[model samples]
Target: MVFKRRHKEKLIEATLFWIGSLTIIILILICLFLFRDALTLFSTHSFYSFVTGSLWYPTADPPLYGLIPLLLGSVLVTFGAICISVPLGITSAIYISEIASPRVASFLKPFIEILAGIPSVVYGFFGLVVLAPYLQLWLDLSTGQVALTGSVMLAVMALPTIISISEDAISSIPSSIREGSLAMGATNWQTIYKVVLPAALSGISAAVMLGMGRAIGETMTVMMVTGNAAVIPGMPEGIVESVRTMTATIALEMGEVPIGSEHYHALFAVGSVLFIMTFLINLAADIIKKKYRFKLEGS
Candidate 1:
């Protein structure tokens, strides 16, 4: 019986290891596919022109394929999204983890989870039909679909991820730590602000990175709301202006682009860029998670 149990455990371990390896294999396959398709675009255009040139007119005679405006648009909306989500998500997590009564936490947690579960299409529709008009009226914009509108929708989508992870991190801190802080005569607010928050700072940062990744890669909502105009903003408030992100550019044009054409390959190249951006973000999250896991364990 002892030998049989040990055999079973070994088999389970090997099975789990193979499953994890499959995920890496899948990621490699995807990157290779994107690179294969993107090579056609690279053969004709200089790397600097592809990345730095401002124009994106793919249908004009001898079409230009600069990624600068799309990259800037993506950065603008993502920055705005992070600005909105991080503070509110962290605050709400703190409230739920430390301050809220059990009943309140239970009630609020479900709603936040529901927000994450909602389909991206639904969010896009809501932004288009409801939020857009309000934003145009409030900001005095010519149209409702602008970078700020996309940012608002993405911030909503990213909030649940940030809140869930941050709350988990704060809750994972041993209760004894809280007790020790209180025993030192610290006020409840002071204990949370100085003790709990600092302890969970790494995890909170990981949560923010993950949320930012989600916001940056989001396609439908950004496409529907960001006016689909590929242009670089000139001012700080230019984030409120109409713009189009890389994801939106791919989603908007990939269908009509003929196969084997430069336009089609360029769209694939854009997707490759988006893939690399998300890959870097997930890598950062992984590093932070491993670092903090060990740090917390050692502490």
Candidate 2:
């Protein structure tokens, strides 16, 4: 019986190992496929010009594939989403974790989870059908399908991730720390802001980073709302302008572009850029978390 139990344990271990290995292998295969197709575009296009060029006329006579406009659009949308979501998410998280009654916390958490579970398509549809008209009327723009509109929708989508993770982080803080701070004559707010927040800084930072990643990578909602113009907008005033993101460009054109053509290869190249950006963002998040954890431990 002991030998049979040991054999079962070994079988389970080997099965888990193969599952993990398979996931990594699939990821590597995807990267290989993406880069292999992406490199074909560079054969006829200058890498530097492709990246720095502002125009994205993929269907033009000569076909310009400059990525600057798309990159700028993504940056603008992500920046706006981060600015709007971070403060609201953190504040809500703190309230839920530290201030709310257990009943209230339980209610709010389920609602946030529901929000997260809502499909991206539904969010996109809401943005297109409801928010667009409202924004247009309020902003006095010809059309409301602009970068700011996408940003607002993306912020809504990112909020759940930020709030959930941050609340967990804040809740995970040791109860002893809070008691000690109060014993030292600190007010509840003071203890929360100074002691509790500092202790959970690493986790909160991770939440923010993950939220930013979600905002940056969101494709469907942004594509549906942003007017899909492939032009660089002027600074300061351009946040309200219609623009196209890299993901949007690929999604919009990939279906219609001829197979084995430059446009096809270029779309793959765009995907490759996006893949790299996501990888770098995740890597940076990890590095930031480690640095903060080290500091907290040292202190």
Candidate 3:
């Protein structure tokens, strides 16, 4: 009976190990497939021009493939979303985790979760039918479908992630830490800001990074509202201008692009760039979390 149990345990361990290995293998295969098609574009297109070019007319007479505009559009929209989501999300998280009564926290938590579960397409439709028109009327813009509109919608989509994760992080702090601060004569707000917040800083940072990743990777919402113009957005008023993001560009053009054409390859290159951006964001978040966790544990 002992031998039989040991054999079953070994079988289970081997099965789990192979499952983990298979997941990694699949991810590697996906990366290979994306990069293989992406590299084909550089073979016929100028790498320098592709990276630095401002034009993106893939179906024009000569088919310009400049990537700067799309890259900048994505950057502007994502930055805007981060600015809006991080503060609001973190603040709400703090309230729910620390300040709010149990009843309020319970109510708010489920609402945020529901927001997270809502379809991205529904958000896009709302942005189109409701938010855009209101913005146009209020801002007196020629059209409401601009980078700012995309930012607003993306922020709404990213808020639930940032808030939920941050709340959990803050809530995970040892109650003794708060009690110690209170025992030291610190006020409630001071204890929260100086003790609890610092303790959960790693998790909060991770949440922000993950939220930014989601904002950058979002396709349907941005495509619907961001005007889809493939031009470098001018500053000071750029956020109010129509611009096309990398994801929007891919989603918009992939269907019509010829299967083996340079346009198709260029789209793949865009996907590769997006993959790298999200990968780096996640890597940075992981590193930050580990560094802070190690420091917290050591101290």
- Per-candidate TM-scores read 0.95, 0.97, 0.98
For model 3, the stretches where C-alpha displacement exceeds 4 angstroms are: none
Model 3 vs. true fold: TM: 0.98
Judge candidate 1 against the unseen true structure and give its global Cα lDDT, from 0 to 1.
0.92
* Candidate 1 lDDT over residue span 1-299, tens digit each: 99999999999999999999999999899889899999778888777799888999998898999999999999999999999999999999999999999999999999999999999999999999999999999989899998889989999999999999999999988899999999999999999998888789788989999999999999999999889888887678777789999999998898898898999999998988888899899898888878877876788
Best by TM-score: 3
lDDT tens digits, residue span 1-299, model 2: 99999999999999999999999999999999999999999999899988899899988999999999999999899999999999999999999999999999999999999999999989999999999999999999999999999999999999999999999999999999999999999999999999999898888989998998899888899999999999997797888899888888888889898999999998898899989988988888889889988988998
Model 1 residue runs over 4 Å out of place are 289-299
Q: Return the candidate ranking by TM-score, descending.
A: 3, 2, 1
Q: Count the backbone clashes (under 3 Å) in each candidate.
A: 0, 0, 0
State each model's C-alpha RMSD to the native: 1.6, 1.1, 0.9
Q: Which model is ahead, 1 or 3, in terms of lDDT? A: 3
Q: Rate the local accuracy (lDDT) of all candidates.
A: 0.92, 0.93, 0.97
